[model samples]
Target: MARVVWHVPVTTSGTGSTTALRLFRLRDGRRCAVGFSSPEALVALLGPDQAHTELGEPALRALTAPLGIDALVVDPRLVAPSVTVPAATQPAAPLAPAPICPAPAVRLQRR
Candidate 1:
């Protein structure tokens, strides 16, 4: 089975949301982000209902350096990859053999 890992956490510390989309790490080892069209957007996305802790790139972009956020940027391949499934657990299978023909007896006609 393929192993899955989260990108850790990034803390915004409540800054830098004035511009640029917040970048952060996701649980699936992928970068996450939340782009706000306006100041209202940011406020709506991250409400002041309570001190919020979000994961992924959105949190990373909102985040400044380090804190409670455990966001960790990881390799792309770790998250997604182009792969081919094996036919069976073991390889080395025998192939079918070619066919053989019988000899025909030719009666010589003496002229």
Candidate 2:
């Protein structure tokens, strides 16, 4: 029996036929491969627009191992709300430059 899991698919440039699995980052900045048990699980966290593919556990591990990603996050939950920026109608004005502060001088005395 195959332990099938859902993974987000990332299309490669140049050759449209080639594709790759999307890797995610952990809270500690470590790269990890994310998978979901079902399509509904994937969509719940990544939204319905996310493209996905079903693969076995071994296959997912084999694909990500070479990329230095040994950690696999399954059915992970979103920690923060997704932020969406509104489109700007007009070009906004540039912000003022930050004020520069001079560092204090330190003198060392040799005994």
Tell me, by TM-score, which candidate is best: 2
Best by lDDT: 2
Local error of candidate 2 at 45, Å?
Answer: 1.2
List, residue by residue over 1-111, the lDDT tens digit for candidate 1: 643322332234467353332355576655544333333434454553423333444445346344444444333223435698867877778987867877888899999
Q: Which residue pairs in model 2 clash with each other? A: none
Per-candidate Cα lDDT values, in order, are: 0.44, 0.81
* lDDT at residue 102 of model 1 (Cα atoms): 78
Query: For candidate 1, which ten residues in a row score worst on lDDT?
Result: 2-11
Task: Please identify model 1 stretches exceeding 4 Å from their true place.
Answer: 1-22, 48-111
Candidate 2, residue 100: how far the Cα is off, in Å? 28
Query: What would the TM-scores of all predictions be?
Result: 0.22, 0.63
lDDT for model 1 comes to 0.44
